[model samples]
Every structure is written in structure tokens, then in C-alpha cells.
Target: MNNKTDFKTAQQFLVDNPDIEVIEVLLIDLNGVHRGKWIPRHKLQSVFEGDMRIALTGVTPDIWGRDVPSLCAKTGDGDGICVPTVRTLKRLPWLSRPTAQMYMHLTHQGEPWGYDPRVVLGQLQQRFAERGLIAVVAPELEFMLLSSERDAEGIPQVPQTRINGRSKVGGQLYGTDIMHEFADVLHEMREACDSMDLRLDTLVKELAPGQYELNQHHLGDALQAADNAQMLKRVIKGVAQKHGYVATFMPKPFAHVDGNGFHTHISVLDENGKNIFDDGTERGSQALRHAVAGLAATMSDLMLVFAPHRNSYRRFAAGTHTPIAPTWGYENRDVALRIPVGDPQARRIEHRVAGADANPYLVLSAILAGVLYGLDNKLEATEPASGGSHEQCRELAGDWLAATRDFEESTFVSEYLGAPFHEAMCAVKHFEQDEFNRTITPFEYDAYLITS
Candidate 1:
């Protein structure tokens, strides 16, 4: 389905949604940030006439929106042409104003910008294509819905009542009543998803109070899956705000509760449209094993993408559902890589390491790259872990600093992701770390003021 949108398609979209007053052309950056411009309805045609001009450094900002001067993003912050991706053209049903949005990719001198997350995923997909394979992917995103208002101390609090007037409580995992509690919000979210062509599969109540999980329908095109994941986050946040709730995808929102996880399920298919992971038996095919082996072997090196933020590591505690070891098993939730029990044709590897906050493009890239690596080298996986995999298990880096350091030093990352991307990502992370270190936390002030 080569659904690349051109100016004629954009014109048709404008004609169909004649009420739309504006268009938002968004480009996903290396940090997974949506950077773009808004064009008035009258000028929307110009967007398709040629590439939209934007500062090349628009995609290189840290979380604080600080630019990395080392990338030369500040040589007058020169303009890069942004080409609109037609497949992403859709109406945002949640917005009150008549507005439309489209995803975009940036290019300089007609070559894809290496730092663009969308470009990164597209590049990785090409590698799969070269091997006569296609990866099917789905990302199950978990998040929390909180009251828009904060507490006296300015901490976020879960809403006390659902639309049904029931008090919000914890440990409501898989409870139907909990789903009913947020029925209106979820229904509206579904409407938004349908309007935007986002294939949302399920919504479930999570373990924490006001926590929820939404699984996307598996996409045969892994790149589109990442694009949908990114768009879904935007939709959820937008819809939640309209419903007077604050939606958060932060990995660890509370110290005592379970954290949000972005678990990905993947399966590869051959040129003839046959499942390469299925050998028509209980045990998956050799290709599946090789994919698992690659994932397990490279898990440590890719921790930075899975757990990107400082608080991301907080989800990896002993009792948390998050995996602390690089292990695999059949239908085992305790292991990092689980081969879910399902129909033989539907067999796939569920990668459970990434947090809800990680960039979908980077996460998918790391996973696909690992699978290719395993297949290229015919890597072998260790025995499946029966119980908790932590015992005698290889632990992921204990903290963000260690994880980022490992990523920066990894030859595999440099080779597969390309050195320019690797260096820029590492530089941005290091800048963030340095910026964070300069901040004096309340705990530091209290501990030092009187005792020291």
C-alpha cells in the first residue's frame, strides 16, 4: 500500500473537510517530540506545492527544548524542507476548532535527515526489505489519567470519581467496572481514533488507580505502527484534556504504584506473505529463536532507548512487573522476551522492556535491528526462564547514566543506527543529564540545610 500523499490528495482532503480552518504539519524529532507549524486554511495548498521550510535544529532539541550547538543546528538554525506524509492526514475529532493534522519527514538537499525519528524507522524498515522480510509490530501503551487540578504540594492526583460517581481506587486490574468508570472518555478517544484511522485494539484497567492500557491493532508495516503509537499518544492527551483530565505516560508516576509500560509485539513475514516465525508446531520456528536471541543479546546495549528518562529506571524494582533481566520464555510475563501462546500462524515475540515514555521509533528500531543482527549472525538464545528471571540473570544498567554510557559506547548502535544519530542522541542525553545535575532538589536542600 504505497499511500504516499501528494498535493492532489491534500487538495482532496481539504475539499472533504471543508470546515477545517487550519492544518498542523508535525515532524517527530529524535527526542520523539512533535515539532511543526500551523498553516491557515487558505495557505494549506502551499504545503503540498513544495517542502515546508523549518529550522534544521527544530528536531534536535532536548526535553527542555535546548539545542545542541555541536550538531551545527545553530548555523543561523538553517532551514530544512519538510515534506508532508499523506497517510497521516486526518481530522482531530477531539479538538473544538476545525483543524487537521499530518505527519511529516524532514530532508536537507533531498536526503533524509538522520536525526528524524520517522526517518530512522524508515531506514530500519529498508534493511528488513533488503532481506526479503517485513516486520509486523504493535505497541501496547499504558498510561494514567489524573485530575487536572494538583494537590496543595502541586503533586498530581488521580480523579476521585469516574463519570459514574464511583470513587477511584487502586488495584483494579482487569475490572470491567473500572472501564465503565471512564466510558465517556474512552468512547470519545475511540471516536478520535476512528476518525484518524488509528487501529486501537483494546482498553483495559491497569493495576494503579486511574491507570489504563490501550493496545493498537497489529500493523504489518512496522513504521506505520510506530507512527500510530506516536499519534495515539497525542490523541489520548488531547482527548483527556478535553474531558477535564490530565493524561500522563510517565513510566513511574508514583513511588508506591506500578509504572506504565510500552510492551511491543512483533512477528516477521517473508516475501511470499507467509509467517516466518511459525513452523506449524508449539515451538516457534528457527527464525523466531534467532530473533529472540538477538533481542536478548542486545537488550543491555539498547536500554537507553527502552528506559530513556531518569525516572524510567524506577520501574525496574524487584516486585515490579517490569523485567529486571534479559530473558525469554513461552507466554511468560516475568521474562523480558515472551513468546505468547496463540494460534500458530499468529505467533510473535512480545518485547516487554520499553517504558511508555520512550520514543516509539527508537524502540522499534532497536528491536528490528536486534532481530536482523540475530538473523545475520544466527545467534542462539539461552534456556527459557521458568520463574522470575532475575536470579542469575544479566541485569540491565542500574541507572540512566549507565544506560546512556553503554549506548554511547556500543559499536552495534553506531553501526546499525548510523554514527550521526548515535552521536546526536548521546549528546542530547548527556546535555539533559548535565542540566538535571545543576538543579538542587528539595531533598538535597532539606537534607543539607539542617543536618550538614
Candidate 2:
């Protein structure tokens, strides 16, 4: 399913959906933002044939969509060919106009561009293939649905429930009634997922007002898992807008409420289709411990990948159900790595560190790289925390700046993610950090004005 689209496939899609007037050719950047061009339907054939071109800087933009000067200076901002992924070609169900969208990665002179996030994940996938191992991954993503209108101070407001068009306050964890309040929009989202082939498994009301979590069924291919996650987010946001609401994946939207998270469940299988982490026991096999140890060893260095923004740090406060340390435990939600309590064959590690806003491709790449590192080094994990693990292990990077520095200097990250991509990520992060440090917030002015 990861194969590049052929001309026949593109022509057949056009023939089938004759009404599709425009096709959106999308490229996922380092910040997980979609940057692309909407070409006429007649041009999709040229896109599939690798004739479509976009600026090479499209994949190296800062969070605000500005080009990183360092990356741009190096490449002279040349153009790269866009190659469409056949599986991602789908019609946009939420759009009023007859439109279609497809995800693509950049290629320079017929070789995969190292700066592309999908290509980086693909490199890690090849590593797993070389070891005769396959990683099955599923992501649980949380997001908030807010009103399109803002308050007097221009702050987003919780959307009114469709049941009575009244705004509700307080968290309603797993409330079926709350789910019913937004049934019409959720049904449209589900239909969009079905059309896109995204295996959306469950929808649950979260611990914050207007917050919700959706889980995707596990995929044997990690790349496809990330693809499904990216597409699912788009589907949710698009459908919500069509229903007169705004969907945001921000990690910590409100200071008083629980934040959003992107928890991933992973299980490794051998070439013979057997779960290598299962040793016919509840405690699982040594391979599982190795993977956990690897994740713990690298969590601090890769913190920037998990929490990329200033507000992302706010999601890590104590008692927020966000892991502050690289602790591992059995069925513990407070730890970074959790071994679920289930049948041995279905046993897997649940990574709970990344924010909902993190890039799915990079998250999966970091995770699979850690697993491979642990397996190759035969690392042993620490004793699993019984009750909680936050105090049992050291904390993650203290802030966004610290995390960016850690990521910039990590030899592990450079080696696994490739020097080119590692450098590009560091450059973009540093630029964003500098921009953030130069800004003054309203809170600072209010707290210090004439008081000192």
C-alpha cells in the first residue's frame, strides 16, 4: 500500500470521480502542517508521473509557515518533485466543491528527500525490515471542539452542545450523553473516515469539557498507522468545521482542564507472524524489556519531538495524566511506557509521552528507532513501578528550549533519523524557539506592571 501511484491508478480515479474538479496535493512538513498546491483535476496525472514540483523548503518550514533561513540558504530554495502515495488518494467528503486530496513526499533528482518526515519514517521502516521485525502501531489522539466565535479577549469558547444549543461546563469523562450531544457531526466524521479507509475504532468523551479522544485500530505497518492518524485528524477538523464548530489538536488549550495527548500502542512481530514480545507469560519477554529500556534511555533526548511548542510544555504538569518521566510499569497510565494487561499474544507497550500536536511520522520513527536500539544493544529495563512512576524516574526536559537543545545535540537522533533530517529539525526548532523568546505575553505585563 506504500507504493507510489501509477498513471493507470490516477487515470482510473479521475474516471471514477469525474466530478472532482480540483485535487489537493499535500506535503506534510516538520511541524505536521500540510503545505501543498491545489491543482486542476487534469494535472493529477502529471503529479502521479512525478512532474509536479514544489519548493524544497516546503518540508522545512517553522511552525508559523516561515522558511528557516539556515535551510533555505543551504538549498538555495530549489524545487523538488512530488510523488503521490496511492493509498492516500481520496475524495474530500467535507468540502462543498467536488475535490480530492492525496499525500505526497518530495523527491530530488529521483531520490527520496531526506527532509521529508514520511521518508524519515520510511528509513526506520527499512531498518525494521532488515531485522526481520515488523512494528504494529495504533495511535489514540485527543482534541477539543470549540466554537468558531471568540470572547471579548479573543479567546476560544467551548462549543454549545447540539442537544439544546447551550454551553456545558466541567469534564464529562466517558459520558455517553455528551457523545450523543455531538452525534450528527461525529457521524459525518465517521463517514469521512470510512471514505478515507481510516480504521477509527472508538470515540470517548475525555476528562475536559468539549474534549474527546478517538482511537485507531492497530496496523501492521507503522507508516500506514501514521498515515491513518494524520488523515483522521484532517477528517475530524474538516467535519467539525462543516458542522459550525472548530476542532483543535492543541496540547493544552485551557489552563484549568486536562490537556490533549497522543498515546501510541506498539507491538512487534517476527517475520513468521509471531509476536516476539510475548513469551507465553503475563510479564512478557526480555525483548519487551529491551524496548522499554531503549525508550527510557532516549526519551529525554527526543523530548522535542514529543513536545514541540511552548504551550506543549504546559501539558506536562503533575497530576494531568501526562508522564513527566521515562518510567515504565504494568498497566500504569502515569508512566511513559506501559505494558497493557491483556492476553500475552496481544501484549504491547503503550507510549504516553507525545502531545496530540506532535507529528505522527516523527513520533513513530522515534519510537521504532528506540525499539531497534534496545533490541540491538540488549538493554535491560528498570524494575516496573507498581503504583506510580513519576517520582521513580528523572523528569523529561524542563522546557521547549532545553528540549530543543537536547534534540540538537543528540548523536542518537542524528544517527537514526539521518544527519540531514536531524539538522533540518534542529534548525526549524531553534528558529521557532528564538521567535518565542522574543515575545512578551499579557500575563507578564499584568503581573509586573508598576508592581516592582
Any idea what lDDT model 2 has?
A: 0.89
List, residue by residue over 140-259, the lDDT tens digit for candidate 2. 999999989989988889976654356355667888897887889988998989887899899888988899999999999998899889999999999999999999999998888889
How far residue 312's Cα lies from its native spot in candidate 1, in Å, is: 0.9
What does each candidate score in C-alpha RMSD?
Answer: 2.3, 2.1
Once fitted onto the true fold, the runs of candidate 2 whose alpha carbons sit more than 4 angstroms away are: 1-5, 160-169, 389-394
Candidate 2 root-mean-square deviation in Å? 2.1
lDDT of each: 0.86, 0.89
Q: After superposition, how far is residue 328 of candidate 1 from its true place, in Å?
A: 0.5
Query: lDDT score, residue 170, model 1?
Result: 65
Q: What is the TM-score of each candidate against the true structure?
A: 0.96, 0.96
Model 2, residue pairs in steric clash: none
The parts of candidate 1 lying over 4 Å away from their true place are 1-5, 73-76, 162-169, 389-394
In Å, residue 26's CA in model 1 sits off its true spot by: 0.8
Task: At residue 281, give the lDDT of candidate 2.
Answer: 96
